[model samples]
Target: MPVTPSDIVKFIESRPGRPLSAREIAEGLRISPSQRKKFYRLLESLATEGLVAHLKGDRYSLPRKQNLVTGTISVHRDGYGFVSPREGQGPDVFVPARFLREVMHGDEVVVRVERGGRPGKPEGRLVRVEKRAHTTLVGLYEQGRKFGSVHPADPRLNQPIFVPAGQELGARGGEVVLVAIDAYPNEFRNAEGHIVQVLGDPSDPAVEILSIIHKHGLSHEFPDDVLAEADFLPEEVQPGDLEQREDLRDLPFVTIDGETAKDFDDAVCLRREEGGTSHLWVAIADVGHYVKEGSLLDQEAYLRGTSVYFPGQVIPMLPERLSNGICSLNPQVDRLTLVAEIVFDAKARRQSSRFYPAVIRSRARLTYTEVHEMVEKQLAETIERYVDLYPMLTEMLALSEGLTAMRRQRGSLDFDLPEAEIILGVRGEPENIIKAERTKAHRLIEEFMLAANEAVAFFLGQRDIPLLYRVHEPPDLAKLQAFQQFIAFFNYGLNLEAEGVDPRALQELLAQVEGKPEERTINQVLLRSMKQAFYAPDNVGHFGLAAEHYCHFTSPIRRYPDLQVHRVLRQAWRAGGLAEQERNRLADRLPEMGEHTSRTERRAMEAEREIVELKKCQFMAERVGEAFAGYITGVQPFGLFVELKEFFVEGLVHLTSLSDDFYTYEEDRHRLVGQYRRRIFQVGNEVEVLVQNVSVERREIDFTLVDLAAQQTTAQESPKGRRAQGKSKKR
Candidate 1:
């Protein structure tokens, strides 16, 4: 029952001293979820009318209020910053440069709302800085006459940290150094720091990557205690290890992975059942068996969250001894595993599923290319090498197709976008940038893993267990509507309605636009509109996979959440329905754990992206004068960004380079049109460009527009003009 305005007022006033958040107010009013949007609007209206006080951090109280709002301040490189509210459904208040006297990015701050504005552009003034996100900054140290300055590795952290005389800590100019902040700047002076550690000169090829690693705060080397703990992990499965585990070493389980893959976390085997059904044995490496809870290894793994992968480097969550040796499901070696044994019906729906500890010796370690050759191309050498497993491989192909069809039919949105694959030399220099290839071999393993993950999540969720779920929330309504309007320009029918988004609708749109000229553009737009999937204690389901139940059940060697899930499941297996004590403890802590893992996961991603981007920038730096044909991917008032056809790099072509005519930006149309010549440059337009510059510091490549069309037109016109001039000269 929705409470009346009078009832809401009385409840709010009842808590006289303390403030009530929007969630609490809604709960008190018995407001259901469906009316949440409207309820928020009502609260906003009340606040605007001065009937209710919306105070600091969006908490509501009596009519008397303070203008201060508390949140995290994200300072833009241009000096301005935005403070996102800490407590309610409100806009991020923008703080001007003058008010941000000593603020840096990621500071917990209190802001005074000067006035109300649009949700996207609210105005505010900084009142106080509650907490500083970082005490140390990593960057290049430059020695000045009076003092040294630190150029931060992160470009967004634009302001240089000043180092006073004799505080350089023997760090020379152009060297990457870690600086510890001693003082934060005010309107009177610049922020000051002292050099703590010299990481080497930025001119060194390796130092660039080193700077990126430190900037993201990722730990690469394991601690001595953690490494010592890993030594206790068995090199091979012993009799004691398999005491309570089912012995399945005789089964022909095989590991399928890339040629360069060192750690094998999962292995699989299939058996055909009666009535056109199949049984899948997905044996995952038993990391929890070796990495006991509260141990040094477990602590380190949790801190890392997930392994970070670069072009030719991998920072493993666990030590190499565990990730690649004992815990890896190596062929011909007995490995302990937690298996999700599943039986699927003819329609590829899981009929029954069970999980238990097991020991398995993988028959062979197979590469994707080899599998593709054996299964798809029917290569003689491949068949002869694995002649005994040939029959099982063929059956696995059929099963994989069925599972793929089942997922697709359920409205799973699979984006087949091309991802960059950097080929590095022995010395780690990028030799070439190519799109990562996906074969049937990749899908075969993917389908099996997806099934096992879904099975485990469904089982745990049904039991009312508190566990981490890989959740993807639905897209924001405003972004979806904006996307719909943009796609309409291509005559594509993408009518996002008030009923909210569904995976099915997005899936249908992608299928319809496949192989079209606008395929990549539409795919990029739709992907941007979707929310990022992350770990959560509560299950809202995975939207992209169209899965009501989904979690990371495999790859414990690299991901912490998978290891956590394994630990929880193993305990439940022994104790049976976790006691109220354990359950309550998990319920209290899982949310925080989920948030930490998610942040670490994002940290790893940013580090990887930064490294790859730096390599791409370096590659483009050598070809500054070359010309290339590419397509316009983005358009803005200042310039258009074009993605190269062969190189796969995107660079900006500024509007000032349009020599034929002055171009004016059309914001709503997403295009730049010439004022006099009427020439147009729009997203998806093909054009030739000359590489203008590449800035390693900014991690940007620049291109200048090449007027091939105008050049050809001029060439044809010149001959006619020359012919008339010749006639006049002959007369």
Candidate 2:
């Protein structure tokens, strides 16, 4: 048979991250010189097919595979690394520290697959650095007479950059400074750098956030041209711009979000139609109207991809003039909006939907708390304040219930996972960390937003127009089977088929486990098993939401994909259809745009999660001696991970703390069983622990189990990492 795409792909994949020359490939595939041109073209096609990566010197390698992987490294403080693949498949490959001498965390690299330390798994051998995640890093400078060394704030970047005394840039020994790389590490040479920016003293509490900003290369300031364009934007909705747009200013629309939220990009209202029907209006700020495509604002927004929100700080994508001023649907202000008018019949089934540009005056700016108080708890003051909108709000709640029921019936999974909500003090210190509950009011807006998003996505999809789609493919079969085995410990088995798992099966499993002590663990495992939702040119149904067509149509101010969709919607709306020429142009660009937006979105999420995690560590650092009641969230061979009920802070309890007997880990039960006493520490078991040690460097806290039966001791044992201590007797 002639050389097929699969044959070429498999051959390249066998040597993942290793480039093979076309001539070599031709020889390996038995292609003569006369047939070489067609094979060469075929190799080129493979290079651009998103499967194989084309390297310099006319070489190629597989971009995605279990063996030879291509992706970014996530280095742990322990010196080991995990490679998160670009293709978003498989568990991250483990790279031992011995192979990590040349690469830092987040560096893009190809890894050659090797036999794993564990059975039925694979390990990775570092291949080559395709791209560097950063050329600069933020670290503390230690000045010396002859030279200065900077230790990276990110412990994962263990290599200290050697900075010459003259290159210290006047930074003191204890000061934090940003260092520009003079050289990347190699087998023979260590990395070197020169100080480019001298940050303030490490003692500054605000420096923590600054360190994260610098570490992630996030900018708080906009370019001069972008700023100038933002400044020149009209401060209010102008009359001339109102042409050919619906006037919804007369309607009673309201903005409902958190009290601390500054940007109200979406305002919602509802009207009861005859025959037990409901007409819902979700008006999102028409950012596209002000920030035209290819404009400075558009370029900046696309670059940012999405806003990064740290506690008490927000690095917005658009300038405040646009994101918070005109584009924000502040109460009593007339803001231009793209409206999604959806009609749901008695059974809460979407009957008809329409999209158009409109202008609306937000009558009231409510919050999730206030709405929850009035609707669910029936708070007196809240009801009296928005008395006219009270009836409408209750009706909206009823409609939300109906919509939620329909969604639940369609096998949509609702993971009742709590979020870590950091409460900041006046001085930017984390005063408290609590679990943020997802309330009915939050769900109310969510149901409406989902309806609108789906309607818009379905609209464009049916037209065969090229637009970025939010897709979540099904879980990998191995992961699904693992999860099924895990839940079997709780006397539950998933109704999964041999072909693969279904969303409904997972949904049914969650429903079955709800309210049980194992609910949290099950939810976490299920979430981990599922693929992440991302923006892509391809349409794969969103598994989490169980929706056939879904795109991010809300929050255009913060997200780039939503803005791009708005622009595409306008083009298609104006032309009555996408012109063939325009469609082809978009087809060429949409795939790349999807990839870029997805990457940036993940970057923002990582930055946000890191900051929150760091703050949690800092918060725990202050209360080292305090004892708190908690539950065993995770159990490994070395320790039990516990989440304190009062503070929502999770810490590790080393195996040494269980002084009564030695313990061995049982992977199937996710627990440690004592060898002699047969005592067990497993997931979901409530336990009390004393905060022993906290390491802001590792972003972790150490806890010791409080032997409530034994006499309380003032002595606190230090928290040791899994591999930090000597071997256990059981081991």
Question: Backbone clashes per model, in order?
Answer: 0, 0
- State TM-scores per candidate: 0.88, 0.90
lDDT of 2 by residue, 258-283 (tens): 97999988999999988999999999
Best by lDDT: 2
lDDT of each: 0.86, 0.87
Candidate 2 lDDT (Cα, 0 to 1): 0.87
**Clash list (residue pairs), candidate 2:** none
